[model samples]
Target: MAQQVQSAIPARSGGNHPKGLPYLFLTEMWERFGYYLMLGIFVLYMKETQGEGGMGFPAVTAYDIFGTFIAFTYLTPFLGGFLADRKLGYINSVYLGGALMGLGYMGLALPGLGFFYASIALIIIGNGFFKPSISTLLGNLYSEEQYKDKKDAGYNIFYMGINIGAFVCNIIGAFMRNKFDWSAAFLSAGVGMFLGLIVFTIGLKHYRHANVLKPAVAGDTGIGQVLSLVFLPAIIAGVLGWMIPGDILGSDSTDAFIAATIPVIIFFVSLYYRANKDDKRPIAALLAIFAVSVMFWAVFKQNGTVLTDWAQNYTDRQVSESMEQAAGKLYLAEEVSSKESMVTQYDNQFRTLKDDNGKEVKAMGRSVYFRNIDPARIPADGKPVYLVNTELFQSVNPGWVVMLTPLVVAFFAFLRRKKKEPSTPAKIAWGMLISALSTLVMVAAVYAGHNGEFKVSALWLVGCYGVITIGELFLSPMGLSLVSKLSPPRLTALMMGGFFLSTSIGNKLSGILAKTWYNYEDKSHFFLVNCGLLLVSAAIGFVMLKWLNKIMQEKGVK
Candidate 1:
């Protein structure tokens, strides 16, 4: 298989060009389309009732499931990268992973609960292979001299393509869900993934050269050894944790998950110790950055969790008849009749209840807003207000991603010309600090709303996303650039896995925070906690900056 892959490799063109790039880009874009499409509806699907063809889970449960799924998806890149580097070769793994993920997406559209969970498991494992492999391929392409200077720009462009898919998929999800059923929306994700597979196949001639299998390094364990040590122990530990624990992770599933990850995490840490002296420092830096960046992910990923709830129920979504007609025509606004709107404030005035079955619940009323608002603020007509869909708020980050990428690139370019640009680490610190400020915007919005007395304007939501997007522009891309710049050549994919692991942990934290939404009486404190977390993370990054910069310079990265 390795020989066949090697023989099929396109000859490298002169001047640092690898035979891949375009194929990888399109494959990534379509892969992101499927992933983001599923994400766009995941929360909504969870919150939906069984009568509506959903699992009918509570919001907290849904958040946990959502977080766990994304967490594991990022967590798997370690295995994927290893397999690509040692045994399977990049192309075969990509094909295998993409096929699994596409089928998983299709399976999700099937009608059984067992199928749903199984499909999610498949997708999660599949992503581990597909995600890091493509990224490593890009790095390998740039290893040639002609492309080395352009690697950062290439990654930025690739990142933009990712956001482009992310930006568009929500719209597709919205239309599909509104026009048909949730199943249709999920099915669309599968179709989009398959399309990505087809695009990758078409572009194979371009990237086949980059798919050459790398020889294993000295002292590298065999694939059998790795699987025995990592996968087998992980499975055993996970089963034991799930079976013997009483809420070790607050739930059996969570316990199993945390246990399942221990082996993988330990393996990566061991790599640092096992690396040759020349490789250790860079790996150490990568690990440090990974640790600090988890906090950013924890805070940033709230767009689909706590923040989604805020947009759904707290933001002022009311649109006038004329404006509604126009917005609806543009597919930007969703119209709900008075009876259908879920906008509600769970204030002291609202009496909680349960039937004999112990299913604690609240009474259905016009808008939940009436429960918390002063009498004067309640609408006299009792008519339901037309509001924008909560999912649209998910677009804000990507929207900012698209709008600000060029501007950010230009800003860095300007600084580059002067040689005054912040190091990538510095930019990430700045991103953390600026992101903290964005949370304060929400703090102000909460105060302005008088502690849930009235809903705030959607403009507030826009302002927050806009501010955070700037921080994201600084941090997210820079993180990727840092990984590309600092990782040892042999361990690039594993380090990329490290980067995603940070994201995975943060995503889980985001869910954990969102799970506490029901416990907070003063909502401003919730956002303030997020602000404090980011601020502390930023501080830590800043304190480490000089040392980190010294390493980057020693390593000869800009």
Candidate 2:
């Protein structure tokens, strides 16, 4: 990979992007389509009753599994990047990874707990091999002089491709699952991955030249060294954590993740101490940023669980019969009627609809909104209504991303033009602070809805996502750029891996917080915890700003 970075690589003759861009774009679009599709429905599947064809795991169990899956998914990219750098070329790694993910998605559609667990493992391993290689291959494209100046712009376009896929996948999921069954929804994800593989193969002629495997080089940490120093100790620690009697930190999985991180953290710190004199300050600065960034990621990643809970159970989702009829014609919404069997068995919420004569009747489903609707707002009894699909809420964040990206870019450009833009570190600090503010939006919703005994408006969730989207634009993209700018030349990939490690930890912590949903008596307290974490992170960033800025200036990068 380093050789590919420094070698004289060929470039497209014209000013246009290489022929690979469109192929990679479409390929990644489809890949994300598959990923987010399963993710959109995953928890819903886990928590559903067996009669509904779901796994029916307990809420905390489901959330813990979700967090572990998400954490391990991020964790493997380092290994994937390592394998690509050493042995498997980019093209082959992508092929292997895509194939595994496709199979995993298919496996998820099948019955049996064993298949489900094994499938999750396959997808996690596949993502490790697939994710970093493609990104690295894409980065190699801009290494050519022709594309150098437009590197950022190229990535912006690529980033939009990801959001486009993410935003659309949930609608696809809602339609497939609501119309047919869980099997159909999972199968759709598999098909999307397969389509991505096909597109990648079609574009092989363009990027194939850039996919060469890099041989072992001086000062590189060998696989044996990594195992002995990091992997071995981590595995032992994790086993110990899992084996300990009783729950040490909420759950066994959480305990294992925290324990496993100990050795990994030590390894990262050792990198700082072992760095050459000139590299130490930059490494320290990036490490500081990584530490602060964890809180942001932990809170931000709850979109799939905590936020999904709100969308599924706490918001007004019922639609007019006319609209429902129209949407149902296209299989676009979940259909719930006033039928007696539609109510979740043995758990009918206390509620009654009133007629013109003032007699009481029932119109209800498993949707929490209906379970707790104010009687005054209930339509005349025995009316059928359709609820907006729960999976559609998954699209909200990515939808915001699509809408907000250009605005954020223009805002920052405007600042840069006036020489008033915040430095990268400052932007991240403010991003955390802004994220804290977004939690207050949910707090307001909780109060407005009277602790969820009343169905709140969907606008509150949308509003929270809008604010967080701005913060995401500030922090996420900049964190990637920061890693590229500050890392020591030989250690660049390692630093990138380090950045992802922080994200993996944050992702797990999100799950830990989410698992506490049942523990909180008032739903408002759930969101408040998210607020507090972000506030603490922002405070840390503010305190470190002066020293971090000095390091950035010395390192001569933003």
Which candidate ranks first by lDDT, i.e. highest? 2
Residue 176 error, candidate 2, Å:
0.6
CA lDDT scores, all candidates in order: 0.77, 0.78
Over 1-558, each residue of candidate 2 has an lDDT whose tens digit, in order, gives 212212211221113555566677677878888999999899889977676799866666888988888888877766676667677777888899999999999999999999999999999889878876776666666657677544443444455556778899989898889889999999999999999999888879888887766665555577777779787898899999999988899889888988988988898888788777888899999999999999988988888888888887788887665687788787777765543333443222212233576333333444334567665545557455677888898898889877776566657656766878677788889989999999999999999988877888899999999999888877876776666567775454556677777888899988998888777768788889889989999999999999988887897654
CA RMSD, predictions in order: 5.3, 6.4
Q: What lDDT tens digits, residue by residue, belong to model 1 across residues 1-558?
A: 223222322221112224455556667778888888888778878876666687767676888888888888887887887788777877887888888898888787888889999999989889989888878777777766666755665666567667867888888887777667778888888888888888778878766777767676896657797799998998898898789747766666677777887887788788789888887888888888888999989888888887887787678766666786766666655655445343332435222233578354545565553444355544566654556666777777788887777677767767777889888899999999999998999989889888777778888889999999889888887888788899876667767888998888888778777777777788889999999999999999999999899899999887
Candidate 2: worst 10 consecutive residues by lDDT? Answer: 5-14
For candidate 1, give the lDDT of residue 501.
85
Per-residue error for 492 in candidate 1, Å, reads 1.7
So what's the TM-score on candidate 2?
0.88
TM-score of each: 0.90, 0.88
